[model samples]
Target: MGIVLNQSLKNTIITYLGFGIGAINTLYLYPVLLGATFYGLTNYITSCANVIMPLFAIGMQNSLVKFYSQYKTIDEKSRFLSFTVLFPLVLIIPMLLISLYFYDEILYFLSKKNEIVKYYVWLIPFIGLCMAYFEIFYAWARVHMHSVFGNFVKEVGLRLFSLLLLIAVNFDWLTVEGFVYATAGLYFLAFLVTMFYAFGIQKPTFQFAMPSNSKEILTYTFYIILSGSVANLLLDGDKIMLNQYMIIDNIAFYSIATFIALVISVPSRAMHQIVYPITAKLMHENKFEELNVLYKKTSINLQVVGGYVMLGIFVNINQLYAMIPKEYSGGLLVVFMIGISKYFDLILGNNNAIIFNTKYYRAVLFLGVLLVAVAIGLNMLFIPLYGIMGCAFATLLSITLYSVAKLLFVVKRLHLYPFTAQTLYSIIITFILFILFYFWEFPFTPVLSIFLKALLITLIYVYINYKFVISTEINEAIDFVLNKIRK
Candidate 1:
């Protein structure tokens, strides 16, 4: 927990910093500078890329994390690392060739509804390939317990560059189309930087041979591909669906609301970087007792922190929407729906790591695939009736159902659960805070009002959690920060 805490805190700070920049870009600059249509197009390109990224990488990122700790000899580890690096190319090359062969068909399918997407259709695979390799290398770093630097590059570096690019657009240095192309270049740059950093951490021996456990490795990688696709589909499939069913500008609105809601997941995202490899190590060693302890601790800890984030956002959602454009304000319901779903995911803690590392992962992945279908079906059914709000409803329901299924599967199969008494207490605290803050606001401008309200909420939330000691780990963390401040 000590290493997990140290690295998780750093990753959390880096992630929030990135999200802050993303908020500025998504909520203000993109809308203000590029206008809603191009803003939506920009998001649409990235969302489509993310949805296809797993197929390109063929699951090497997850395979690295799950298998890296199992090898005892450096030669064996080197062989495995080399395999992870090289294996994805087998699928990537063929996929690119296929895309080239079917280029016109692909463009027609993507642009049938929206012609603006036709010009940018090529960027999806290019960017997805970059994203895929970046994760493969980023996973390379995580397996060695060197996640902070990769995380900094991932969370802070890309968003910071995006901020600069938007400013470039503002200064008339780059046209909007150029901004889109340059963003794709940024993805490539991120991949290159991470690849070099990963090599710096463990200079790749670049063996031509496969790992000794090639059969097991290949099988796991196959399942991971499905799992990764399912996960990404859950995250970004709605946006792609929106591109299909609605106008491109609506996606910009959905993007804004979703971005605000996504801040709740930052703690889970941060903790997963460190906790995932540790969970893999524990599973490899058959350390079920330690694994169980970790399961409970991560659950309660993330719940406390994620609850705070969700609370802050939900309570102050009005002010947040106020700061954005009026047309985008209709996404208020999207925020509530998506925010709750993200909070539900956060409380599951390392539930994903536990499932992914276990043998039952195949069954869980099958369930995930089914839920992806369900999600798409739901979106198709709802989008015509409602709008962006309908997409949000579909996302919320699909994610919640998926989350509950994962939770139940872990409990039924492993006999481990992520909840304790603290889970209930944390929920109660969150509920109370929401009721108290949701209906009131300081009579000031949105920025100042948000600051004062967030400050009040933070102080009160921290005090109650500290007093009740909802999580001993959280309490110790608070005390540690306070002691450092006193010195």
Candidate 2:
């Protein structure tokens, strides 16, 4: 818990900083500078890339985390690492070749509804490849218990780079088309930097031979690839589907609302970097008792912290929409639905890591694939009927159903639960705060009102959690920060 809390706090700060920059870019600059058409195209390109990234990497990133701690000998570890790096090429090379061979047909298929996407179709595989390797290297760093630097590069570095690119667009130094191209190059740069950082941590010995556990490794990688695809599809698939059924501009509107909603998951994202590998280690050593303890602690801690974020976002959502363009303001319902879905996922804590690392992961992967099919079906049914709001509803229902299934599976199979009495108390606190803050707004500008409202909410929320000691770990963390401040 000590290491988990320490690194997660730092990662949370970094992630929020990135999200802040992303908010500026998504909410302001993209809409104002590029306008809706190109802004939506930009998001569309990236969303497509994200959806295909798992195929390119072939699950090496997750495989590295799950298997790295099992090897005792450095040579054995080196061989395993070598396999992770080289194995993906088998799939990546063929996919690229296939894309090249059917490039024209692929373009026609993707751009049938929206012609703007035709020219940028190539960037999907290119950026997906870059994303794949970046995660592989990022996982390399995480397995060694050095996630902060990678998190910084991933969270802060990429968004800051995008900020500069947007600034370039503003100065008329780069056209919007150029901005899109440069974004692909930016991902490549991130991949390069992380690859170097990972190598510095453990210089690759380049053992070309496969490890002795090749059968088991290959099997796990196969399931993980499907699992990763299912996860990403849940996150970004709606945007891709939007491109299919709606005009490109509506995606920009959807992107803005989803970005605001995504803030609630920051704590979970930060904690997962460190916690995934630790969960893998615990599972490997059969530390069910320790694993159970970790499960409960992370659940309560993330619920409390993530609940604060959801409160802030949900209570002040109207003010947030007011700050964005009027056209994007219709997504208030989108924000609420997606925000609730993310908060539900947050409270599940390290449920993903627990499921992915265990032998029963294959069962969960089957369930994930079925749920993704359900999500796609829902999107197809809803998007044309209700536009962005309909897409949000589909996302909300699919994610909620998927989350519930995962929670139940973990409980039924492992007999471990992520909730305690503190969980109920945290939920009560969150509900109370949301009700009190949701109806009122300070009589000032959106910016001032948001600041004041957020400040008031933070003070009261922190006080009650501290007083009640909803989580001993969180209480200790507050004390640690306060003591540091006093010194």
Candidate 2 residue-wise lDDT, 19-77, digit = tens: 99888888899999999999999899989999899999999999999998989999999
Which stretches of model 2 miss by more than 4 angstroms?
none
Residues 50-167 of candidate 1: C-alpha lDDT, one tens digit per residue = 9899999999999999999889999999999999989899999998999999999989888888899999999999999999999999999999899998899888999999999999
User: How does residue 21 of candidate 1 score in lDDT?
Assistant: 88
Q: In candidate 1, what residue range of length 10 has the lowest lDDT sum? A: 106-115
